[model samples]
Target: MTVEPSVLSAVDAGVATLTLNRPKSINALDHPMVTAMDELLRGWAAERDVNAVVLVGAGERGLCAGGDIVAIHRDASALSGSNAGDDEAAACASALFWADEYRLNADIARYPKPYIAIMDGIVMGGGVGISAHANTRVVTDRTRLAMPEVGIGFVPDVGGTHLLARVPDNLGVYAGLTATHLSGADALALGLADHFVAADDLDAFLRTVGETGPADALAKYAQEPPESAVEGRRDWIRDAFAADTVAEIIERCRAVGTEEADKTAASIAAKSPTALAVTLRSLRDEKPTLAETLQREYRVSLRSLLHPDMAEGIRAQVIDKDRTPSWRHAEHRDVPTAEVDAYFAPLPDDLELTINAAPQEDSSV
Candidate 1:
């Protein structure tokens, strides 16, 4: 069956809500959805009737699971065996998608209005790229956030490395390397989420925003609400992820040898060695602002699509439906530091922020 495009956009009561319509795929981002969102966002930015914007998923599970890897598999299959000569062309096409998607991600990072991301379910990888950069990022009890790029033999793109760099006290490295999911309280504590509300209460809260008209009015409506009580195991995360390199991180986890640490270590070990190594080191030193980070990620992402590990990782995880990915480089030491450094190498830096410098006057549109 052919799938329709994933995004549905509408403006109501001065609020523009962009819903991810692919409930069956948990709103996985396909090429069409990416293009649709990019075009729609640019259009909405110029309209005067819109006040605020809310981004959400259509169904009960997630805002977005991630990229449609099955499609990637099909694309890859066409390049194998008798079609080996087509590999370069396929790689270029994949790069184009990365460029467009990363640009869209940068746009969200710099959105002008008081944009809010109502993260209700499993928000991982590319989903974080779209929402984590919003002005007001909200979390519900059901929200699960992670940057699981390494699992797919890809470095964190969609500005994930940039966001992870901004995270405090080495926790970003931990999250990036392990692809561990964070609870609402954990996310808020780590500064990844702004507010935490019960999932059941989310509808009423949004309805109140629709009626209130202004942000101040919405604030007053939510005022005196109970404080968020989501608490996460932060100390362990900080300790486990403190090492400067991927190898060191694994060593630290093994040193602890606790059940949790062992599990974390083993899990990370299962990912692409090159991806984890590069991601850990990159997040440690990546110093781009929101927009700059997205651009940098774009460069690295464009290069990665052609790398053997990315396709192999996707094959194991998504296409074949097997959880075990055989990474090109099985150990952190197997990835040359020089290759890791290349991911951060400067590009022409042609990318521009979609939001520019916030809305000039109230941004109610």
Candidate 2:
């Protein structure tokens, strides 16, 4: 089979393994990577040689860190201008990227065949969207899972909001607000993963079950996934994060007055305050299908690029390697509802996606 430069695909024993090969950048998804993966998934659906697919990362460091935000920032910067003509052209280009990225994420969700994601390290934000909803999600000892869009002055995308909405109680809101990283064990407990095992045993487990193995045997194999230091904290997380808003959840954590809550609160307070506010609101707002939620997220992202916090957050956290962002909006309440509503504004019909199933409207999982 002809291989794409960004992705390495190999079919062995009817199990197709697609490894995200950009280890240098922790397999961060670029436009080319997204396009390549989407195209290959389409082809895989038709290939008789491939019965199952294992999505793995090339290195020990990460599965996919997130999108190539550095490239995204550079593109946005290059397109910025004072002239109306330049501004319009830039906006058009940005919108197209968002639409395509959102569509690709949707395809992964509804893709045929049993999809297994070997999430080894630093799965967050867009990474979560890529793997969270898969049939079998395997987490290793090194796994650090989170939806950290809030830190970057963005609400969760890649269907994170939709998945978060389905999680019980207000945990989704808490996760979105804090962008907290869940250990492999916690991921299983939170329904984000199927099982937990030792990182060292992952290779043997994969080989034992092989690709296209029986469902029952696969479940047994998952029971041996990697283990990490973070475990036995679910009760506290569920209790502290049970409220519907960040402020409420913070207050609950404060009420606990333990070091863990204190630490979590402090960690959250360090992120973009505006993003935390919007994330909570987004979590509590509505239930949409993966596609609809992605569309909404795209709208938020498109507007966020123009917002001061996005560039400032990236500058502090990435470009400068500093952790301080001077946000344009300091408080969530200070952000107008109209601004959030503007993100959901009707796009041109041609831009609307019709591929995925419509979302069922329900708050409860």
Each model's Cα RMSD: 4.0, 5.5
| Candidate 1 stretches greater than 4 Å from native | 1-5, 74-91, 214-233, 345-365
Candidate 2 minimal-lDDT segment of 10 residues: 356-365
Worst 10 residues of 1 by lDDT: 222-231
RMSD of 1: 4.0
Model 1 TM-score is: 0.86
Residues 183-264, model 2: lDDT tens digits:
8876775668876656777787667557437364455555654443334445676787766556566677778878877887
What TM-score, over all chains together, does every model reach? 0.86, 0.85
For model 1, residues 1-365, the per-residue Cα lDDT tens digits are: 97655788888988888999999988988777888987777777767777788889988998988877676555444443233332353245555566667777777877777678888899987788788888888887788888888888778878888877877767777778888888776677667877776787778778876788536434643322233222333566677677667777788888886787788888888888887876776687648676666656665664455456777888888778788776767677778878777666664424322323332324452
Question: Number of the top candidate by lDDT?
Answer: 1
CA deviation > 4 Å runs, candidate 2? 1-4, 75-95, 211-220, 224-245, 350-365
Per model, how many backbone clashes are there? 0, 7
lDDT of 1: 0.72
